[model samples]
Target chain A: MGMTIAEKILARASGKSKVEPGDYVVGKIDLAMVHDLTGPLTLNVLKEIGYDRPWDPRKIVIILDHQVPANSTVTASLHQQLREYANKYGTNFHDVGRQGVCHQILAESYVKPGMLVVGADSHTCTLGALGSFATGIGSTEMASVFLTGELWFRVPETIRFELKGTLKQGVSAKDIILYIIGKMGVDGALYCATEFTGEGVERLSIDSRLTICNMAIEMGGKTGIVNPDAKTLEYTKCDSCEILRSDKDAEYQRTIEVVLEDLVPQVSLPHSVDNVKPVSEVEGIEVDQVFIGSCTNGRLEDLEAAAKILHGRKVKEGTRLIVIPASPSVYIEAERRGYIKTFIEAGSVVCNPNCGPCLGGHMGILADGEVCVSTSNRNFIGRMGSPKSKVYLVSPETAAATAVEGKLTDPLKYVRS
Target chain B: MSAIKGKVWLFGDNIDTDVILPGKYLVLTDPNELAKHALEGLVQDFYKKISKGDIIVAGKNFGCGSSREHAPLALKYAGVGAVVAESFSRIFFRNSINIGLPAVISKGARGIIKENEHISIHLDEGYILRENGEKLPIERYPDFLLEILKDGGLLQNLKRKFARRGEV
Candidate 1:
């Protein structure tokens, strides 16, 4: 029987010729990641079990993306502990100022094709855009991996999403994913491996592909994978590497077809990531804050998109706009390109590269009875602030346009020179 | 594993990690401190209301978003004996097991179980005994997972394994 790319990757990691769905295999870890929020718990678990050192320090990656710069005394202490642990173990650590979002940092260089990766953050599946079978695990499970360098898995059945045609001007990979999640519902792909393929996927830039894969977890996907192609090779600067792809006759539990040419700006209403609608349906709803960064949409292209929209315009008088780059590299590049200046001139507060307001970790939290138009993933209830506050998830362009009007506005509704 | 008896708390679908334990409280490491915020997003003062050994019976897609293990740890520390749901998100399921929280999947758990009613779960026997004297079948844990549960979570299980091999 033919095997999918995920099955093939699992087979290689497990030292088997092939693996079928539901088959259990204990696989070696190529890379493991954890951030400030989850890292301390993992170390504590190891200490409780009396394992003082990681199996392979170099294989582990730690970062201070969440609550960076220390939101409180507790967070400062947690960051201190992570710094100590990273020093003791000699693991690859990206601390404050040097850190962006965890997944974004991995995408910058750490992630490579065909590797079996795991992280303590659910959004770790975002790394799968690099063609790795990466997924999220609990901190306790990560402790086991830290010591043994191995974790068991029940191979998930694969769900293939084949996109075709060109994306509309204002429509983005974020919209495409939001539309899929809306149709599939929250548990539509529970415990399943999702593969994004077809010509439309090939049309996506590496950053856009990352955006699509980052939201797979919103629909309960174990991981979202994209086949490594020429664009992927260029991004990773790989001269020679095995580019894994599914067989022509490989089986998929189900296949969803998306026609990208017909897609428009999509928005996820407050309280749920999957409660989506066309931006036109919910346009003009007032917003108090606008966020333009997170692991989902904090890449260079996303910043450029927002900057382009906000370049010559001013943010509405009553609204607040906050832009955060995903990583230091993105931060430098955006600054070099003057997007940062454009944002500041537009009356938006451009923060450092970290997860701000997305998880309500820090930087820009919503107040009671307020509404926010954000480009981040997951609009779950109270995700950004008070339980009474509401969040609407939109594309970067939409976020910027909404910021301009202090309401939910479609990007295409305005004309740019 | 012995049968666990607890009062029931009913919840709807998609009780995500943010609701289970909001991101603002992710900074806290102590389980007891984390417990104070359990379900605070969904139900105010829920932790104070919960008696030790209260089971949560939820609709489909419980623990749907975020891979924060704090969610399960908070539930465990908040005196939740087990979580009986129609289904659960993959990461949540794994986190629950790793934290020694029993997350049982019984299709009709929400419909058959009433809030504030008492129920008993026989994990090893693969059924939940409700106050109505009805036995509801649950999806049994696989052998490896069952072993982890028997040892009271992955931490203890790993300790036992390492001790046997003389690695720690």
Candidate 2:
């Protein structure tokens, strides 16, 4: 039977017919996730349903990144609940402290080509970077997966984003996505699948693809995918899994292309991810906080890029710069490269590996009327604490440079060649 | 239950799940406790002022986030009469119906309604009546979904379905 990449994968896993966008199908899940915050509730639900054993222990991954190190009593309690559940259920991966955000850890370790991954967190779309059709579900659904190893989905219409041209120096993939959001608006990709391809995407690294797919939720996309390539294979280390590309005549609901050769660093103004403009247009917008962490850009490459600009420099007085590595492995890698030292020497506060300050859980929360430039996805009101606090979404380079300057600036101005 | 009457509060697009129930409060299990935090992130003290049977009017993409059933549970516990949005996050919309909450979609909600305005929602009729007597049509719920809501959430509905199947 003829099939698109998504249809082929779902059909194999779900044992369903040729699936198309908007067609509801139920399939076995290749993977499922739960974290400290939501694990207890899921456990409680499972108990209520009287499921003595999980459908497959190997497919479940439990994590404690939301409040890593248990900063408070509540967080500590949440962690305990997760540990208990993982122990009882025999979860395959129990990532704790600095292990990194769930999405990053999954991408680094388990996510592979053609897998259907689902998590209880929205950013689970990060696994789409590995050519998996991954998306987020809720605790109850996760509980169901734990019981039956299966879930249902309605196929989504596919929107093709064709990128062309090489990115300019100091302009990262984050900037490119920000630019796309600027053009398409926050709701542009709502309820659709975003398929990235073309010359521009081919030039980006796997980590960069993770960054792009990670933020698909901001555009309201169900998930995002890129045709697996050499780089994707290298990153995932999946030699045995087959790599699927869109058929030459594959159908798409819509297509949009971007030329990256002349693209500048982009910034998404506060209150909405789609409220974007070029960095030059919003220069001199003073910032009180600068954060470089979250599943999106908290990888090793992201830290290295930020440290290169922060070396031997001091952050602007009155500004708080927070850098959190996405995972413990990323933290170790950064430490080995002395990136952490450079960041601290530059007057930045380095936090443990976790999704700190990105979702306003803990650390780096902005004060009322304050402005922060963050590398995380989503700058919606109260996203980082206090609805009055404004957040500007930008690339790590822009975030680092702005931390030093206390305003939005091009990182090229300070980066050493 | 007594006939609930209240005014409708209308909002514009992209009302995410985070706004309805902040991620920070997801730990709480009590629906009443969660009800107090509903929309706390956006409109401070929303729960404290909300009366029984008040309605929410919003533009597209309402209830989008980690499909915590708590979202609709909190809204229902807060005594919300019905929710009218232009569009909805797929899971949240389904969960609302599964939990017996009245969630309707209407294109004209944003243009005609205001925050804290007095109105009446006729669930069976699938329309909202404004103080000025303007009636806005809403998408009617499917028969199955309405039946599930009437039975008070999916778990109860599922139990009934299984019991009937067992007898057969």
Candidate 3:
């Protein structure tokens, strides 16, 4: 049988001629990462496994994100513990402020084509945008990889999404993903590898592609992969890595064709990423906070989209807005572009990226009964703060417009200009 | 590998890890501490109501968000004998086996079993015998995964490896 990109990647890593769905293979790891939230536990598991150091320290990257600058004494100690371990093992370490978000750091620097990347963070699948077979692993699994440098896989079946059409104004990769999720509930692609194909996918900028692939986890997918093109090579800086592609006659569990023009700016309402509605129906719902950040939508372009709307306008009275760039470099670029200044002048709090308020990790946490419109992914109950508080997931444009009106507002008006 | 019987608690589809164990309690570092909040987001007072040996029969994609092993650990400590969902998120499925918790899948279990209905499971046999004496699809452990559960968990499973390495 012809192979899909994911199957091809797995087959190569496992040193096999080919692997099919449901077939088990023990694959070698090219890279593994852990951040502050899971780093301490992952390293602890390595010790329990009786490993003095990682199998290959050079291949491991450790970053202190999640509760960075340490939220409490315990978290501070956690960061300190990770720092000591990284120093001892001589693994690549990006201590607080050196790196912004863990996944963002990998995207900007390390992730390359045709590699297998495993991370302790669920959003690790974000790296698949560059054509690598990246997915999340728990601390225990990560430790096993640390010891033997190989982890097993079930060789998930691939679901191809062939995107076609030109996106209308205000519709972006985020809208297309949300639209797909809405159609394919949370479990639509359970344990499946989703590959983006066709011209529309190739047309997406790296930032937008990151937004689409980052939320693959929300659909219960193992990973969302986009084939490598010139844009991918330009981003990863690799001369050539075998850009794996699905054979035309390759079998998939199913294939979805997404017509980009049919999509609109979308929102995921309270408590579920798949609980989506068009912005027209959700407009005017009062909001208490508006945040634009995370590994999902915290890139320079995301910040620029929000800045374009907030440039001369002050944030509405009694409403709050917070902007966070996904990486320190993105922060510098946004600053250079005056997006940061416009955000501050518009009365929004710009925070150093550390997954602020996205996982309820800290910074701008919601109080009881408050509702937030955010660009970050996931709106599970208490995902922001109080279980009673609510979150609506949107693109940066929608989040910025919501901040201005103190309610969920459509982004098309701002996008047209 | 043996037969185990329990009363079941029914849950619906897309029950994510956040709802199983909220992100707030992630720092607890103790499975028992995390257990108190299991399913609290979906079924308030879950810890208080649940008894040992109770089963969680859920719809598709149970335990889907965040690769937190705590989600399975929480359910295990909360006294769930096994989770017989329509399907499970892969991370949660792996974590359950690594932690010695049995996560079973049965396509017909959801519609057949009611909350508080008694059912028995056979891990090696791969079937859930319902109250009516009807056999339904249950989680069947493959040889490799059965090894993880047989050794009692990944920790024990790994400890044996280190011991064998020493002999080498």
Candidate 4:
């Protein structure tokens, strides 16, 4: 008779007393985000509706990434379209260099516990780390939200992930998610809400939690939810919020308990995120590129982790290492902490916040027969560049270590004692 | 109810939206231009090899990443009949249904069908006709989704709804 976190959030957003899995309800959207890659289509659809203005301009956030600095004339025009729409409607727009990535910027300011966020990008689930219910939507669906500020939800069934024990040193939240994805396979949590709870999750930093929730989509999850705790409250400075929780007797479609103490460094092999192997197994595999960034792992902590490994070491010859902070805030923090200078001195190309190379947009695209060990999610064939190239997914620690030895080397040996 | 027939084109698990339509072509607003590049990364000459009524049969987690409607739009414009999979991503499932492309969920379908094979689907009866003449039950959807498909998609259905509202 108790409700899960997702059920409670949907019920509250829809103004209903009670709702359950499989029930369709239209919920009020608190925040909607769009970036340069998808904003033009979203704006065109809204224009087709003949809307004099947005249903609520302040409710939306727009960022120009994917092709920052205008990779091409086409991408340049896209930024223009988004800018014109934002100016005409007086919506909140984060111009180039004003922000890094949309989700990172949104979490820094907009996201709140128990809010419902629908974004135009799949990584919108990254906001779920703040204990908000968020998911991706298409341009037409975004247009509907622009016109009515409402969208439907199916009150997804919840899958409880109870993390026990503590993560080993040199192992990170990225490894935790990669291990889960490997165990469950790609379709493990299809159409379900995978909620991370228990003591281990409580100890995870906001960046780690964001990294975990960002990949919930890889398992076909509707969204990943973590109840607002002390850390959440402290970070958001939100006192006396709704603070939703699943009842002790709440029903779950599946309950997976991961023991962090036993987990070692994990690496997702080429072509598939679910194709995972322990770092020991893939040791000595040489790589041509080393990338440490994405919405999944481009936070300040991620940069710090890489910088810690590359502080006084130079990258091996024939290896290309690129570092991108998740946001301008992260970049500024890295500068203050001297991680930027340390990286440049160590032979890594530290760029601004953008989705470059992750989706093959720009920056460090790979060539045929090349191999890259990356901190980003999704290692699908040709994800970074040529289909003949290979991508190995690892933690920032492993990426930095690999960049040094020019092979797949675990950072555990190189971590400061 | 009519039985839709098509030749099967097989694929494995997790055929994401990005592979269906790569990010490189996302800038092109034209659906026809997108169709030309459909599955071209994995399958060379994908658009040319696809028959008008060819159906795609894949393993679990089909259309997994990204919510771009351009994905299903590419397949629709490329003349794919329907996508039969073991499971599908939630957003991609809804996008495909709204776009009026039949996305049938038939468990163990990958083992049942092979490349370039023929299969038949009974939309009303919720079953698939294997080449060996065996019937496999499919997960049935709400009548409303079929109603939308019958009227040729959500866009057309919206037109009908607005027309009816004017009469009221």
Candidate 5:
């Protein structure tokens, strides 16, 4: 039977000639990942399972990007445990200040097209941008992967997102995804594979495609994918000449058509990614914080977009803005482009390359009753800080404008002519 | 074996793993510490209010997020007798099973479960008794999973199995 790129990759990886959605198959994992927070727990689970050594040390990666610099003694202990675990197990460790976030670092160093990657973090689906079938698993499953280097998966039904028309200036891939979430609602893509295609998607850069697929979880998708094209190959540095694409007769659970021209800078209102509204509709809603980071949109392009708006303008007083580069490499790139200087000059706090305020652990957490506009994926209650601290999801451009205006303002209105 | 009985609390769709155990507390190694934050966001004072052997019934996609085993660990530690959802996230479902937490996917469960209604789960019988004494049939868990739960978790179950086989 004909299949999409995702189906074909899963089938090949699972050692099956043909596999359809809903078929439970166990497959060898090409890449496995764990971050600082969960790595220790997974290692403990591995010990409990009586696996003294990792199945393949080279295939395992440990990233210390969350709670970088060790926020507290507990976090310090976690990092120390990860270091020991990596050293003892012979797994590759990207210590804090060396690599960026786990998702970005994995995409940069290891993820390849058509490979099956699993991580202990949910956003590991970010690797799907490179045409890989990447999904997140729990610590115990990760421990299993550490021991046996294999995982079980049910081929999820695919949802095709066909994009058309060119995106308007200042409207980014983040806006397009937000617009999709708004239309589909939070649970529309639940437990399904989301595959991006069409002309609009083709126009997006590799980083942009990663942004789109990274937020798949916000809509409850198991994983998201963009077919491996030149952009994916270039970003992934993969020389595998076997380019994967969806078959013409491939079946899909659902197909959605998004015209880029019909889209605008969108925002997911407080409480849910699907609670979306156009920037114009929510104009003037006050915001106390603006965050521009996470695995979703912390790339150089994302920083450049925000810097373009923050140039020569200071963040509004009483509005705290925090920017985190997704990876150390992206941080360097942003510095080379002077985005960091621009942000700093504009009074924005440039945080280290960690998932700091996005998960509400440390660094720029929102206060009670406060509202924040963020470039991160989810807007669930208590996501940014206190349960009462509302989070609004938007593009980096919108976050920048909100940081400057101290309110929900259309980024288009603030884009310099 | 004693039957686990509980009252069911119904929730809506897309109840993510983050809502179960907020990402901030994921670093905590102890299940009890994680349990304190279980459902703290969805229902304030959930840990304080939830009693031993209470069940959580939801529409779909229960426990969807980073496959941190802590989510189920927190729920299990918080005294969630079992989780009956229309569907479960892949990782969450597996983690639930590995941790010996009873997770069943029940069709038409949304209609039968009411918040604060008494229900008795008969694991051996593959059914739950509603407050009105109606028998709600459920999918029977695999024998291996039942044995694991009976042993309290995968670790203990593995220990027992290995010991019985004299492989240790």
Candidate 6:
């Protein structure tokens, strides 16, 4: 009869002693985030409703990421609107140079354990890696949250992913998630909370855990979470915060066993995130571009992993490589560590800290008939550009390897050798 | 809620937000302008083909990617009466309801409905009626969500709440 971590969090937030799945409750929000693309729309709703100010400005975060530096006049105007709103309301705002992907910014500083967080971007679920109950909401719903400082929820059932065994070399968190997504189609986890636990989770770094949780939405999860442990505490720099974990007898709708040793470098084929396969099965397919960035895989560790592969090699002449750090802090750290230099020397353009090309909004959009190997989540049609183009989702290791060969080459060859 | 009648536009599984409205168009706040690009990732000029009061009938997991309200707004502005899928991504379902667009879940929607077929949905009655008079059950909204829908959307509902509080 013990409640899962998700139930406990919702219970605490809703001021209830217990909450079961399918039970509707209105929960107080701890953090609410909005980004450039969705922020403008949310602000427009507030404008329409004649709501003058947010209920709690300090708890609200406004970040500019998706179309940073103003892709066009329209985007620039949108940025202006968000800035004015933030300045007027005294909300915590991250502007152009200070901004990163909203989720990355939240992970780097704001997210903490046992909190309820909501953001207007789908990848807001990324912060659930830190053990908070974070999920994505639409702009309109976010506007409501901004006004009332609360939102309604139907407590979702939990699906515990029992990860076992250590991941082999050249395979990583991305591979494990891709393997799971392939098994559980896109809707496999629809409306359910995904709790990642077990030995393999302990083996993963916070970055890797974030990568895993970042793709929860791709598999239709309401949120993906990892119980806070030593590594999570270290990453969040919270030595004394209360850590949330599922009880031993916590009720889960189902338990899925993900054996890490069985995983290889995995890739999601074009037009669908669940159309996954081992890199070897689709090897040697030509690629025109390689992108190693986005909220999903643009961390410093991702940069280092890709840089290690491209250290002494040039990108294939016909292939274009673009490396973007997820946040400014990550960018500075990567630069200080020489990963930026390695990427640049390897013929890849090291871009600014923003959501470059992941949303197909800027920087590295693909032309028609182009094929790209990217580390970002979601490979839906036209995700990176032309509907005729294709995207294969992989880890930073596989992306760099593919950049070197100008095709879908497995990373084991590069890393093992 | 009154009954809504619309022609069906059938689609397959996992029709993501990108196919509903690509990221490049996210900057546009105008729903009509967004409607111009609706489903263009799946079909060219799809909006032009949609008549007013048409409904989107699809297989599992329609609206599966992104938290863009523009997706549902585009469909609604393109004159889509409702979207009845086997299932929907969570955020998309919320976005649809928040924007006054109806997102229904009918397990047999795709099986019983054909493209361009006229169908009527009785939201209050919790069923879809095919032209052949086949009654398909649909998931009904909870009372609180129904209140939001009755007020036209979350925005209007908030407006009313603000007026009630004299906070507007």
Kindly list the interface RMSD, in angstroms, of each predicted candidate in the order they appear: 0.8, 3.7, 2.1, 3.1, 2.4, 0.6
Query: Per-residue alpha-carbon lDDT of model 4 for B89-149, expressed as tens digits?
Result: 9888877877778889999978977788899988899999988888988898777778867
lDDT of 3: 0.87
Model 6 chain B poorest ten-residue lDDT run: B39-48
Off by over 4 Å in 2: A1-3, B1-7, B65-70, B98-102, B113-151, B157-168
What does candidate 6's lDDT look like per residue over A1-417, in tens digits?
898888889999999998999999999999999999999999889989987588899999999999889989999999999999999989999998898888999999799888899999998889989999999999999999998899999999999999999989888889999999999999999999999999999889999999999999998999999998888888888877777788999999999998888889999998789999999999999999999999999998899899999999999999999999999999999999999999999999988889999979999998999998999998888999988899999999999999999999999989989
lDDT of 1 by residue, A27-65 (tens): 999999999999999988988888768889999999999
DockQ of each: 0.88, 0.33, 0.57, 0.46, 0.53, 0.92
Could you tell me how far off, in angstroms, the CA of residue A200 lies in candidate 3 after the best superposition? 0.7
lDDT of 5 by residue, B1-168 (tens): 367788888998878777888878877999888888898878877888988999999987787656678889999999999898887876788789878788887778877789999887787888878888788888776666677678777666655654576654
Q: Model 3's DockQ?
A: 0.57
How well does candidate 2 score on lDDT at residue A155? 79
The chain B TM-scores of all candidates, as shown, are: 0.98, 0.87, 0.94, 0.95, 0.92, 0.97
Shift in Å, residue A239, candidate 2? 2.6
Worst 10 residues of 1 chain A by lDDT: A408-417
**Candidate 4 Cα outliers beyond 4 Å, as residue runs:** A47-52, B1-4, B129-134, B157-168
In the range A1-417, model 3's lDDT, one tens digit per residue, is 799989999999999998899999999999999887777777666666675557899999999778777888878878888899889889999997686888899999999989999998888999999989999988877877877899999999888899998899877777888889988989888899988889999888999888889988898899989988899999999896777777887899998999998888999998989999999996999888999999899998899888998989889899999888988999999999999999999999998877888878789889999999988889998888888999999989888888888889998988787
Ranking according to lDDT, highest score first:
6, 1, 3, 4, 5, 2
Best by lDDT: 6
DockQ of 6: 0.92
Which 10-residue window of candidate 4 chain A scores lowest in summed lDDT? A44-53
Quality class of the docking in candidate 6, CAPRI style: high
Model 5 agreement with the true structure over A239-310: per-residue lDDT tens digits: 854666789899999898999988888989878678888999989988888899998989888999999999
lDDT of 4 at A125: 85
lDDT of each: 0.92, 0.80, 0.87, 0.86, 0.84, 0.92
Worst 10 residues of 3 chain B by lDDT: B159-168
